[model samples]
Target: MGNICPETYPDPFNFNPDRFIKDGKINPEVTNPEAVFGFGRRICPGEYIAVDTLYVLISSVLAVFDVSVPKDANGNPDIKPSFSIGLICHPDPPKCSITPRSDRHKELVQNLLNSDPTNE
Candidate 1:
């Protein structure tokens, strides 16, 4: 996956989802979906469900939250991309600000959290 990542992605370490876009659509050439889910017999059985779950989670977050790099003591944005390498590569949580996009979004999220039994 690491090998193909650099080859397909311009900046493999950066969060550049636009790389997957081609003519306003998802470009299969650069989009390496197989990397997350194994190939052939080793492929994850729940790959479809997993992908759906991720799509929903990411989309929902983006709908309400304005996630951005956190500022350092000097008030300069600090962004150093780091990842954990293994059978499956995943990024470590970076210093960032996760605030609601608007007052309405904040209220919605707050209400959801307040109503959610699991949040307790």
Candidate 2:
């Protein structure tokens, strides 16, 4: 982004998933103390599970679906990728569209969502 919040990341542009992977090994940094789940010593005991779940979910999504933007006539994302600053940070939301890779995939997604009773 034009304005990089170095605090969110001292080197905001850098890929710092060091703890997630390093030397082709899962680094120990994040497993020690992280607030992504709860906080302090009394933090969620299942934090590791949460982390693993996130890894699986994200990996599965990217493996099957394409994540890109809604293209304009020129075949470019309608919006640019920029830095976002707030409680949670991300690349600025892009103008995008999502579609299953195939009818089978669509059905799988629909079935999963429809089967979820908690969804409204």
How does each model score on lDDT? Answer: 0.82, 0.67
Q: Pick the candidate with the highest TM-score.
A: 1
Model 2 — which ten-residue stretch has the worst lDDT? 1-10
> For candidate 2, what is the TM-score?
0.45
Off by over 4 Å in 2: 1-51, 72-79, 85-90
Give the per-residue lDDT digits (tens) of candidate 1, residues 1-120. Answer: 463557766766776668888999988777665656667878789988988999999999999999988787998777777889898677887887789999999999999999999999
Q: Itemize residue pairs with steric clashes in candidate 1.
A: none
TM-score of 1: 0.73
Clashing pairs in 2: none
Top-scoring candidate (lDDT): 1
Please give each candidate's TM-score. 0.73, 0.45
lDDT of 2 by residue, 1-120 (tens): 323456433564654556356688876643433554566778799978988999999889976676776677998556546778887776765556666877888888889899999986
